[model samples]
Target chain A: GESVGLHLPTLSVQEGDNSIINCAYSNSASDYFIWYKQESGKGPQFIIDIRSNMDKRQGQRVTVLLNKTVKHLSLQIAATQPGDSAVYFCAEKTAGGFKTIFGAGTRLFVKA
Target chain B: DVKVTQSSRYLVKRTGEKVFLECVQDMDHENMFWYRQDPGLGLRLIYFSYDVKMKEKGDIPEGYSVSREKKERFSLILESASTNQTSMYLCASSSDRGSGNEKLFFGSGTQLSVL
Candidate 1:
């Protein structure tokens, strides 16, 4: 079965520092990828997404890079703030498929 | 704004009891999904409905069933709740556009604790 997994369970960074979270997916047919942030006691919220055709997509303070060859995905956050402390997850959508599979989340802690 | 509302924010049930989790979306989306979130596991889809009266099992669908008699509401039912069933349940809805290109709008979530 195809699955998405995160590289780390937790990441800690300074408030003003940059944070990078890595994810690896097993399904080669997945064409759409998304990154979501979940605050405590809340559902996952979409942050950014990238298509298989594109290598990278940029948002306000976040960036998503996708490497289909290696089946790796990464989310980078610039100038991390305390509000950025949350669990981040990477999700993959297969071509022509309706369901999206989500990876185990990586907890991000922005320390002041 | 698209709003997905779960009936309960927190629920407590005992073993062998039947549980129902309800979700309603106001966006008139064609797809609705139910997922469970655990401590180590992120979100595992239990079931999804693409249309009224149409339901499909997802990655982790054991001990669960779904109902979608209406397009705007999807329900998840637990036949016999167990301790392991204690987790955060999330409901999401998406448009009927391209198959995989749809972005999900999620509800806050319902935290269930089975004792």
Candidate 2:
């Protein structure tokens, strides 16, 4: 039973501070990793994704770091704002790439 | 940008009733998936269809069935739904562009309550 899990279930950050959410995956051969942000009453939205070949990839205000050696994935938000408060989860692309297994998720709360 | 749309935002049903959850994607994606989300449980795949009239059972496909009559539409059906089936249903689609890493676009999700 392969699984994806997060180091923390919840995180609180002061507005304007940087935030880091971590995830650990069991599948070593998993090549694709994705981060999703889900807000209240809304579906999960794509934040960023990184392939196994890349150590890090940057988006507008977020960076996805993939440490394939340790089977660890992280999402970092720069200058976190109140709007950044949401449930964030990590997913790994499985065999055939059609199915995805997701982590439990970390609830990010940015306090002003 | 891709758009995935679920038929309903919220639905209420009684025990033993049949349920149908509809999903449509405008991007003409080859892959469509149905997943159920629960608190602390994350997203569990129920079923997925890769092409028209073709389907595959996902991780937790016990009480569910799926239909892909058209390229853009995928449907999830529950026969004699139970109370335990109450959960938020999410529909997603991705391109089968041969890349191992698939970027999925999701619908708003249907919050179904089985009473």
Best by DockQ: 1
Every candidate's DockQ is 0.76, 0.73
The DockQ-derived docking category for candidate 2 is medium
Clashing pairs in 2: none
Kindly give the stretch of ten consecutive residues in candidate 2 chain A with the minimal lDDT sum.
A92-101
What does fnat come to for each candidate?
Answer: 0.77, 0.67
Task: Indicate the worst ten consecutive residues by lDDT in candidate 2 chain B.
Answer: B95-104
| lDDT of residue B34 for candidate 1 | 98
For candidate 2, the lDDT comes to 0.93
Q: Using lDDT as the measure, which candidate wins?
A: 1
Q: Candidate 1 residues A24-106, lDDT tens each?
A: 99998899999999999888898999989999999999999998889999999999999999999999997678899999999
Q: After superposition, how far is residue B63 of candidate 2 from its true place, in Å?
A: 0.6
